[model samples]
Target chain A: MKVFVTVGSMLPFDRLVCAMDAWAKEHSEAEVFAQVGETSLCPANMEYSAMISPSEYRDHFAACDVVVSHVGMGTIITASEFCKPLVMLPRRAELKELTNNHQFETAKWLEGRPGIRIIYSDGELAEAISKSIGSDGGSIVETGTRGKLINTLRQFISN
Target chain B: MKKILAVASAGGHWTEMMLLKEIFDGHDVAFVCTMEMYRSEVAPNRFYAIPGVSRLYKRSIAVSVAKLLFILVREKPDVVITTGSAPGLLAIFFSKMLGARTVWIDSIASIEQLSLSGRMAKKFADLWITQWPHLADPVDGPTYQGSVL
Candidate 1:
């Protein structure tokens, strides 16, 4: 199985990257690739880069069976669009991983959503990954909502 | 075709704006985002990158405001829209001052309440929207049209 891990473009999420790398080391059967994003820690067992082009990011998202990420909306939305199961860990404000605790709020709000799993600590990453494999991912995108939003914008722009 | 200036900060905000790409079809759409590399994603259309600012980064706010004002005066777009954070809020404020119609779609990540920037946007935007239906109200806007995600 192929797994893709991303820490997002703005901040370095060493906690998530290091945990996944440790998991990768133990799970030789799984192929792992990561977009590490300027983190000081390097993953010895997984393929990694500091950043990738937007198209490359999409290509990785499309190719992977599961996505590992911080609880960022971009990752969540993209994973939903691709129907890929997502395993997320929220960045803690006290840890200085992000400017605020909004990620925690997002995680709480997304608690029971299908095809997505939220793990609070790095220690839980491995089990979450295991649970996510071979599962059909959930979608947050609603076609009716998209249509209504588009129609409203079209009318407002034209008016 | 109307000239539309679409602004978003990087990451989730940019993703939301791109998902609404279909709305800009056949119109003249220009994009302003935080990351320089994002220019590749919306090529052939005019694109601008500015230093991103947040409540934590109060120092950069002046630079962003000046840059957004410059873009607004130069583009003179007929309409401006953002799926936002701070930069988009600034864009909406400047665009309104420039006599362009403005729309602000709050980021879906702001699930509990409107984002600080989204709240500020309600004052300046011609149309303010929230992705979550529960956040929408008839008296207090950030009306829910629907979500991009």
Candidate 2:
């Protein structure tokens, strides 16, 4: 199984990167790749970059079986496009990870939506990782499921 | 031949704009984004990299708008679309002044309400779209269109 982790560009989300690093050390069988944005957290058992180009970002996302990401809409939507189930960690304003706490609101809003798992505390990262893989057997979302998502977008456009 | 001008900043804003790529197929699509990390992501089409603008950077907003007008005159697009932060709003506002049809698709991450730029767009846009249904409930602002995401 291959896992891709990304914290959106702009802020340094060290906590998420560190948590994933620890998780990967436990599950060495899984190939872990990360786009850590601007951070100094070194992964013990993973390959990572400070930042990546857009095309490189897309290529990594497409290749991964599962993705761990921040609650950035850009990352979430792109992950869904490849049918990659996600474990999302939202940055908190109090933690100085973000300018505001909208990510907290995003996590709350997206709770029951599709194949996403939201992790607030770092301890739950393992459970969410296993759950993401279990939900889809480490496979991408099938085309039929993706088609249905597009249908909803069409309906809204017409209305 | 319909010419469409798509505008946004480089990160989430650009991602949202790209989600609407299907609609721009076969039409002349040109992109204008803040001068940042994306060097040629909007490939195979004409793209303009303009100065960065943000609510936080009030001092530079005017120069950014002036630069945008220069592109507007040169491109002459028939339609304008943006998923915004700050640069997106200026693009749509100027395009509307040039008689282009303008659409504003607010970011899905604005979980509760529309972003401040989305609200400003309501005054002049031909169509206002929100990813959240509740933001369109009052029916006075952006229409609750499902997300392109």
Candidate 3:
């Protein structure tokens, strides 16, 4: 099985790295590809790795059996759009990565909502990834909402 | 057929509210938020900027009270929905006093933990909501609607 892990711009990558190492140690037969930081963490071997660009994100999602990510709106939606089963871990504010703790907020909101899965802990995340190997998971909502979310803004402004 | 003003601090709050954009499809809706680069980037319609307040006041409560009054009088919304920081809490309190229904939705980020704004807004708002089911009732009238966004 091939897994793709894309964590958004959050600091202290050790948590994800630890999860990946543990998963790899458990399933020595699986191939894992991941990118920890953009313009930061150096490339290392699991299967494929790079500090990828936005243009390359879809390809990365498509190539993987499972998607692991941070609790980011764009990342979450994109993972769903591609029908990639997603496992998310929120960056803790106590870790000093964000000004306030909001990722967990996003995680909790997206959890059990159609095609997403929220993993609050590293152990849960590893387990979710393990399940993805056999399970047909993930949700896809209807598109063309760009006009709708925008219209809501326009109407709110006009009113 | 009531006019609802759903106010947030922009960024995550605004984005979260936007998820429910369909609910306001026909209702009269207004948005109030703070002015920061992140807030401006989201570009809310009919946006009102509030002075960001600290947890502890340097001046008197009267001043904050006055600003709160001014906002209530200006918006005159029938209902106020907020996911607060500081400005959002003030909106909830004053909006309620003016006979508007105030619903404070705590940010969804703190699944288990209570945010500072959630704690403060709980005391004065008509309804307090949390994304987490375990937060209990923050106020006598509060309800946890799970996560709206």
Which DockQ values do the candidates obtain, in the order shown?
A: 0.72, 0.42, 0.08
TM-score of each: 0.93, 0.81, 0.51
lDDT (0-100) at residue B48 of candidate 3?
60
Name the weakest run of 10 consecutive residues (lDDT summed) in model 1 chain B: B51-60
DockQ-better candidate, 1 vs 2: 1
After best superposition, candidate 1 residue A134: deviation in angstroms?
1.8
Q: In order of the candidates, what TM-score does chain B achieve?
A: 0.97, 0.93, 0.76
The fnat scores of all predictions, in order, read: 0.84, 0.37, 0.09
Alpha-carbon deviation at A72 in model 2, angstroms: 1.7
Q: Per-residue alpha-carbon lDDT of model 2 for A24-142, expressed as tens digits?
A: 99999999999997677777789999888888889988888788988887887677676678898889888888767878888997776677888898889998888888465222222
Q: Higher DockQ: candidate 2 or 3? A: 2
lDDT of each: 0.90, 0.78, 0.63
Clashing pairs for predicted structure model 2, backbone only? A83-A141
Report the Cα lDDT for residue B78, model 2.
81
Native-referenced DockQ of model 1: 0.72
Residue-level lDDT of model 3, residues B62-125, one tens digit each, is: 5655755776687688778776666678788777777887767676556667677788787677
Docking class of 3: incorrect
On the 0 to 100 scale, the lDDT of residue B94 in model 2 is 84
Residue A150 of model 2, lDDT score: 41
